[model samples]
Each structure stands twice: as structure tokens, then as C-alpha cells.
Target: MRNNVQPSNLSPDPRADLMVALSTDQREHWQHAYGAHPHMYGDQPSAPALHAVEVFRAAGARDVLELGAGQGRDSLYFAQRGFTVQATDFSDVGLEQLRDRAAAEGLNTLRTMVVDVRDPLPQADASVDAVFAHMLLCMALSTNEIHALVSEIRRVLRPGGTFIYTVRHTGDPHYGVGIAHRDDIFEHDGFAAHFFYRYLVVELAEGWHLRDIRAFEEGELPRRLWRVTQSLTG
Candidate 1:
């Protein structure tokens, strides 16, 4: 767990505004979610993602890329495991806290950088031995944009390089919960927020073949999460 992590005055919630919640109209939901519960996001990498990382490591992946590594939980874990990892995200605050946690844990080998996956990836083609998108590609993107991201991963990875990631399901109401009329803004707990999500069609993408697809609809009816895996087929 990340000790001394700063907490924010936000609430954990699932607003009733469905359309806006999943769209960019309410994307900052994550910021607030992490702000309200830094430890939850900082220490607790998703269960499916964690399991996937273990499996990848067992399969001989060493160098790793974490696209949306919040608070460096996964990054530090990989570094401690002796795998070289470069984790990137657009949130400086999140990365700073991640660094603080790493410093506290004495895992100085972990590398954290500020990179936005929406732009061109910062590494050279075939540079990384393996890539971990985690929960990155699913955020605030159109279907085509998400496909482009997958394609970009393929382009960057060397032959036989692996790209691991997870996509939220289409039925997740929390994904696009509340949005303003313009569809780019949302209001929650008396605060207005901005957000987007367009990754409901990962099963239809070209190139990569599905390795493991887990359906997580066992919770409160309609379920809220899905786990999908892909292997780069060049």
C-alpha cells in the first residue's frame, strides 16, 4: 500500500446520468475517483490486470510498458520483480504521487514519465519487449481512435512482442454516466466535470487474436467490467 498518500475531497459514486457518465462529458470521474480514494487507485491495480501481468511475466516478458499506470502500483511491482518498466500517463499529480510511493518503498529502479497515449507513443518502434496498456485505451476515445491505438501498439512492438490491455464493457453505465447537453461536460456532487469513453467494440478490431476474455458480470446485475487479451500477430 502507498503510505502517506494525500486524499482529496471527492466522493465514490455512480451518478444516475448514464449517457454523460461514460462519454467525455463526465470523464474526469476518474480524477475524482482517484482523488477521493488515492489508495484504491494507487495500490490496488485491477485484479484481472494483475493476473495478466503475472501470466505475462511467467511467459518470459521482461521489459514492459504501462500506458496508464496510475500511482505506479504496477510499475513498482514490475521493477521489484526485476523487469524494466516505463510507465506513462498524462496526469502529473498521479505520477508524482506514484514516485513518492516508489521512493518510500525504495524501488528507485522504477521509471515514471509523463506521456499521453492519445499522442504518438514516446518510445521507438520495436523498442519495448512487451507493452501493457492496462486500462488506458478504453478512456475517452471513439471506436476508430481506439483501433488506431491498437494499431500503433502493433507498429511499435517488434515481431513476437506482446501488447496486454483491458477494455471496459459496453453495458457499464458508470463508464458514461452523466453528461451535459453538449456531451463534453458533466455534473457530479455539485461539481462539473469533463470526460469521454468510446471503447465498446474491441472484439471487432483487426490483427490481434484474442487470448483470454473474461466476463465480470457477477456483481450487481448488468455487471460493470470485462477483461480481454490480445497477442500481436505479425
Candidate 2:
């Protein structure tokens, strides 16, 4: 297990006023969640992230762009392994915590930024060697937004670059349990989540080469997830 450190008091949580949908308000919700606790999630690198490191190393990738990098666990892991990492999230508090952790660890290769995946990424075309997002795609985004995000990811990646991400699958026990917001979206605990089906994966892989798909579970909730890996065509 990784050691947990106390986060700085960047801001207080305002979860009481936050909404559970895909809007600017959702950003505050995440910020509140991260601020309310010393650590919202574990410090250990997620399984898909660990797998991505091996894949990227084998592909001779030295730079990685991580979307929705909540607490920078995977970013720190990659930085320790000598990969330059750009870690982004919408939560200001989360990014601040990540910056603190990176500085303390002397991980100069890891940089944090406030970014919303629903918007165009702040990156140059073909600038990154790999793109990673663990459970970012399953957030409260519409189908169109997911497509746009994926397109942005593909645009920023170098030719033959890898894109690795994980998302909650429809098979998850939590699917359709909470208040239904849309077709596959559900709201619970002041957050909205859009679950994905296998067919939706196919739809998302329109331009990229779908390399692999694997199912796994994690956390006390045993959240079912689909780990997807795709490659940009040369």
C-alpha cells in the first residue's frame, strides 16, 4: 500500500450546492470531494495505468499526457519511471494537491494543469507519445462529448501513439441504480456517471485501431470497468 499524505487546505468543499450533471457545476463537485478528504482515492497507481506504462515503454514513449489526473498517482508513477507527464483535471484543489506531491517528491517531469475534458485539450498536435485516462470517460459526459474528447486526444498524440483508458461498463452493479439522468447516465452521491456498453466502445473506436479490451473490478464497491487500449494509425 502507498503512504497517504495530508492534503493542503486549498479550499473548502461546497458539495451541498453542487449539482450531479455534466456542467461547470460538476467541476465544483469534484473540487469539493477532493477538498473534503485528505485523499479521495488511493495513492497506488491504478491497474490500467500500470499496464499502460509497460505498453508505452515497449513502444519507446517518453512523454505521456494524462487526462482527469485526479490526485496524480499515475502521473507520479510515470514521472518516477523517467517519463515526462502532463497531468490535467478540472478540480483546482486536486491539481493543487498534485502539484504539492510532485514538488515534494522532486518529480520535475510531472506537471499539473486545470483542464476539463469536455473542452479542447491544451496541447500541440502530435506532441505527446501517449494519452492516458483512468475512468475519465465514464464521467457525466454525453456521447458527443466523449467523441470530441477522443478526437482531441487522437489529434495531440504522435503517430502510432497509444491511448489507454478505463470506463465503468454497463455490467457494473451500480448501473441504472440511482436517479436516471439520461439513457445511460445515473446520478448518485452528488455525482453523475455515464456508463458504457461494449457497443459504445465500438462506436468510440471509429478512427483508431482498437488493440485490446479487458474487464476488471476494483474498490470496495467492486466497480466493474472496461480497460481499453487503442493506437493511432500511422
What TM-score would each prediction reach against the true structure? 0.71, 0.89
The predictions' CA RMSDs to the true structure, in order, are: 10.7, 9.8
Cα lDDT tens digits for candidate 1, 182-201: 22333445334232232233
How does each model score on lDDT? 0.61, 0.84
Model 1's C-alpha root-mean-square deviation from the true structure amounts to 10.7
Model 2 spans > 4 angstroms off: 1-21
Can you write out model 2's per-residue Cα lDDT over 53-166, one digit (the tens) per residue? 999998889999999999888898999889999999988798898899999998899888888877799999999999999999998776667877998998999999999999
Give candidate 2's whole-model lDDT.
0.84
How good is model 1 by TM-score?
0.71
Clash counts for the predictions, in order: 16, 0
Worst 10 residues of 1 by lDDT: 1-10
Residue 90 shift from truth in candidate 1, angstroms: 0.6
